[model samples]
Target chain A: MKPRVALKYLGLTPFAIYVVIFLAIPTILAVGTGLFTADGSFTTENLLGLFAPTVLGTFLSSFWVSAVTAIVGAIIGALVCYAMLGTRTEGALRSIVDSASSVLAQFGGVMLAFAFIAAIGNQGLITVWLQDAFGVNIFENGVWLYQVPGLLPVYLYFQVPLMVITFMPALQGLKPQWAEANATLGGTQLSYWVRIAIPVLAPSFLGSLLLLFANAFSSYATAAALISQGAQIVPLQIRSALVSETVLGRENMAGALALGMVVVMVVVMWGYSALQTRTSRWQR
Target chain B: MTKQTVAQRIGAEPGRITRWVILVVVGLVFAIPIVSMIEFSLSSNNGHGYTLDHWTGLLSPESARTYRTLFQGIGNSFLLAAVTVAIVLVVLLPTMILVHIQFPRLRRVLEFICIIPITVPAIVLVVGLAPVYGIVVRVFGGSIWTLAFAYGITVLPYAYRAIQANLDAVPVITLSEAARSLGASWPVILWRVLLPNLRRGVLAAAFISVAVVLGEFTIASLLNRVNLQTALLQAGQSDPWVAVIFALLALAFAFVLLLIIGRLGSVSRNRSAQ
Candidate 1:
């Protein structure tokens, strides 16, 4: 590199400093603060709190929601992509879905929760309509829609769109030549998919699955908006540990919860990246 | 004998009906909430009959007092959005261009740093930020706008991808080198030449950053600050109608913003191809 080029690297310093101070330090403290006492001495007491039944239950609930949403979102979104495969890649329909997916993926948080509330909350539009037309009640079993189970449809709302956005490129990368070659060999449609397509797509599909899991696992706003009471999941647990609904500041318990969440995200992202590399080889 | 017939169907393309059916069903899952929002917002306060007071209430003078918290939160979110976008355009954008132009080897490191924020969830990040913010309050005086510092970091992955994609597509180094050979100084080359070409990516990144900032709640709420989402969450608890109304507007704003980003991408693609 020339001196001029070396000088150019100085342009990165501000961004580097900004990221280190805001992102890196907070992340380090998130995990490190969990392993020590408030007096700054080392202790595993906070980590041990993670194994307590209530904390364990919160982790299980978060995992369950993330896993379920990831699986269902992957399947449905892949189907959407599959349906879209025949459409012209640059056609209006493709652009519409692409744009819609990006928007809907961003359209989580309070807006999404409010949308769902208006749709199916107690005395919601669908709630009243369903009762009037079909005598059916979704909340007949005691408002599961307001609890962890309720997070299912809401999570799927964003997850499926995100899946479509992430998975569609891989779907598009499936060349026509492979199908043509499979056809020339007299492979049936099912056989072609099972043999040629499924194997090739497996890495991308699984990669996308992990991405969805991490997304859902890390999601906060929708869960925060929907469930106003109780720490039913890890993020909310972190919230409750950090602050009650009105009050601010709490003990080191939130740090342990965050450390666990970080561990999960890191593992998932690692798998996603490794699988992504496999998918990329095919992209070329 | 039947080999050719089997081969003919190997593409596994679903029937047109299947495609339309899948699209419609999923589209309805998305549309229903939006429609319900509109309907619910137009409904009487009792949730019985239809009315437009909630929508029009936004501009009512009386609402300034009644909905002060929600409006304040909205204003703070807008301010945060602008500041966060500034942080991206000012800090991240130049670093990316520098990496692309001068130190190609650092591209990977730049990407790694930007993407790390995605892996660390905001909720988790807040736990770490709680103590850090105590120090932040000492320096920044506990203003809601300080939340944008965290918002800037949280949006790194999204911002990086948008700008990096454009940086990759455009020949940043070639363009800059050409400008340099023509006696243009580095800053002049950057400001005059590189910025114009990178407009689409910069716009998309800015818009996406705004979207993310406006939706930010966990950090602001936990940090004892109020932004749009926190205020909406509070309003939803007391006055559900007003909350839903504001939520609908926020959704519309984000929807339009993202659609423009998508258009910006393809429009540039077409122009370049032509």
Candidate 2:
């Protein structure tokens, strides 16, 4: 009613229109299409197809990759953060580490996959060097570099850095006074970490891990670049269903897979937010 | 204090040694793959010895044809990045300032909207964008640059948080009132005073937008647009060495860009403090 209030509302108009057009409508289409038939009548076949062995296998493998990367990344990244704790915050070493972590954490997709391939693929530098110098063969068993097992290490390249960035704040929130108090109370280092530090940091750690899992689960380009054939992950499956010329018409199937991914991500992110709030309480 | 001496005795010797070891080990693990990329890129395909062949081969006529797509992809991505950054700044900066100044209660809703993209995975976003893109193409004549509209959304969460941090650090109301009292119009207050103060945040947001655009693959590839990442992946199929070389160069470029932005951010912070 008032011009001042109307102007305030007007400030939000452009972004609201953009969001509704690009984000909100499309997302609704993705979820809504999954519940319908190709003829435009309502049907549950697309959703039901989600439980087929092939589709379910892709989901399981994706979950396995995400979970492994999340757990390992959390432990290693937290350790690195602890090591960082011993350094001066304003020191050159700390700044370099922080900056590198920030850049590398966001570094994924095609280039990242190529980097790993260059380092460890069949004709990679490391593989060739090992054969030349030591008569050892990395492919002695099989060429696993492009397989799901090999993806573990490649995923960690980004995941560990992400863990460092996310987990470092919680680590810094820990006050030295608590450690001093524990020592004064006749507690050993192990007991201090076990009884005090771990409990305080648990929510933050779990939150970071969940974030990492969601990140890895949703990633597509690296896997697509490395594994040329087969839809090994959910993302690849969606890609095949959408673009593979031979498949003809699986558009709704892609929608179904996307809906499944959305559900998982929504749950993971909600939990992450809850844990974030819990962690912030103690932090403040 | 007794606690001080005890902490010194307990943590001073072994703790320092253990900490350094962990730092060094972690650093090496992170650095090795990058080091290996450089080494592999330089080595001869026959494994005889190191050579500049891969670098020189990029100039060959055959390589030129192959590189056309890669170069085009790079150009398109750069253009998209620029447009996305421009759109984000134009749309978000004014809205953020207005909300902070006149309607603080709407801050939560703005934050919630921006953060929703993070929860919606890129693949799902692509799925949603597919049918919409069909209509967009039919209407807009299917230009590659239309991808910027989707990309602007993807960068929303990062750009919003960066600008919000800058906003949170300054007293927007106080600054505006002082300028108004000095007879400065809203445009002058925003452009001269607020914009300069928010330069660091703007730079950070722009850097992130560029990096994300360069690295993004899922949406572009799914939508049938040949962007940098997709082109590189396709190039890897025919000539792996050249592709790897480009990948290394792009990664280094992004790293340098981010490092420069970080330096600029801290320099501006120090200047303000002084």
Candidate 3:
């Protein structure tokens, strides 16, 4: 009532202007460019082309790898978080674990590939051990664990720690007294966790897994970096479409492929959100 | 009853055993790669014999040059993050203030806009930015500055989340109004009242910016910047030992940042409790 100037300043002046310019514009361009041909023609060709068996195989492989990683990560994270609970440790150990977790959590993509290579490549430290001690030949025999199965372990390098960091807080949030209460009622560790801990942790656990899934799905550089150039996930495919030298190759199709990836992401995220909303009710 | 007795026995023993087995397996999975890194770092390039060569190499004059190059990368990262944080603070603080002070109706919309970055993959952002950067650099005579602009957008998620969380924590309307009613100017209110209350958020934001800027790979890799990460990649390609050393160094850097953030968080919580 006192000053119309202040209201005008707050409503549409600075904040809205910045949002429309930087955030809105860039994001709009990303989506819109992905939906159209380079020459500006509208086409569903890119999206439709994803249905090719080779492309579909790439998507499925990545999906399967991510799902396996999520499950393995969740189990590992839950176990570590549970063990660390109610345990006394020196400050150094805690610091070390925390540091390890931090590095592992952020350890991803291309850089991660390099780390793994140094550890297990043909000239790698472990490669020598595997060859000499165990009479195993990774190079000649072509180990599945270092190829198709290899990607999962690499993904888990980040995923496991991610699972730990994400779940640690929620795991800690559960009342210690609740466990004690169950024990007093003559319930065993099994029954106590089954009845109490799992229920408490379900939301955080699911949410963390959803995040990991999305993260693994969108990841391009990790698979491309660790595995050979032949690896073909959706993000890698999209990347190739954008950057490939052959100009005649489908640039518009690439945009459409990128758009298709986003749409799949949206669907998965929406499904996860709806599931989260349903399961979160149990926490209360 | 009899049913209850059977259920209890089956449930208890298996669960405890399962938990222990699961913990050991997972722990090994996480621990093995790290062990491999250390093992590789400790051994010499020529043979499997133990040597402190890698650690010693990191301390030599040539090593100092590498560190200098790394530091330069760190410096560029700091500049990018600092500038981004400053710009975000300048933009976000008032927007936060306006939301609390004048236009509560638009707060949700504002918040949604801020969070849009989290979902946008860095690679996608880089590719989308290619045409823009080409135009900006070739046409407008800006090279790395355009990269910084892109980096600012990339880091928006981290800083925005921290600032937003801080904004949610403090008494925004009361502080702003109190400052305003006392004839304090907008900038003064923001600097004195708002910024002080936002110390924790600012610290968190700074930590996040440092972590993100230091470790960011996609954009820097795509653009082929001589940033530390890309340099490490180049070094790795040229020399495996150098790659191993850089990996160890990276681990050290990550650990230190996490420790600082952890301590800051604990300190802030203690202060708030007091």
Per-model i-RMS: 1.8, 2.0, 4.6
Model 1, residue pairs in steric clash: none
Overall lDDT per candidate, in order of appearance: 0.87, 0.85, 0.67
C-alpha lDDT of candidate 3 relative to the true structure: 0.67
- Prediction 1 global C-alpha lDDT: 0.87
Give me the overall lDDT of model 2: 0.85
Q: Mind giving the per-residue lDDT tens digits that candidate 3 earns over A136-163?
A: 8777767544466778878888887877
The iRMS of model 1 comes to: 1.8
User: Which candidate leads the pack in lDDT?
Assistant: 1
Could you give candidate 1's per-residue lDDT for residues A161-259 as a string of tens digits? 999999988877888888888878777788878998889999999999999999999999899888887899999988887774222232477778889
| Model 3: lDDT of residue A227 | 55
> Which residue pairs come into collision in candidate 3?
none
DockQ of each: 0.68, 0.62, 0.32
DockQ of 3: 0.32
After TM-score superposition, the amount by which residue A51's alpha carbon in candidate 1 deviates from its true location, in angstroms, is 1.0
Q: Which is the leading candidate under DockQ?
A: 1
Cα misplacement distance, residue B186 of candidate 1 (Å): 0.7
Residue B134 displacement in candidate 3 (angstroms): 2.8
Question: What range of 10 consecutive residues in model 2 chain A has the weakest lDDT sum?
Answer: A242-251
lDDT, residue B158, model 3: 68
Worst 10 residues of 2 chain B by lDDT: B5-14
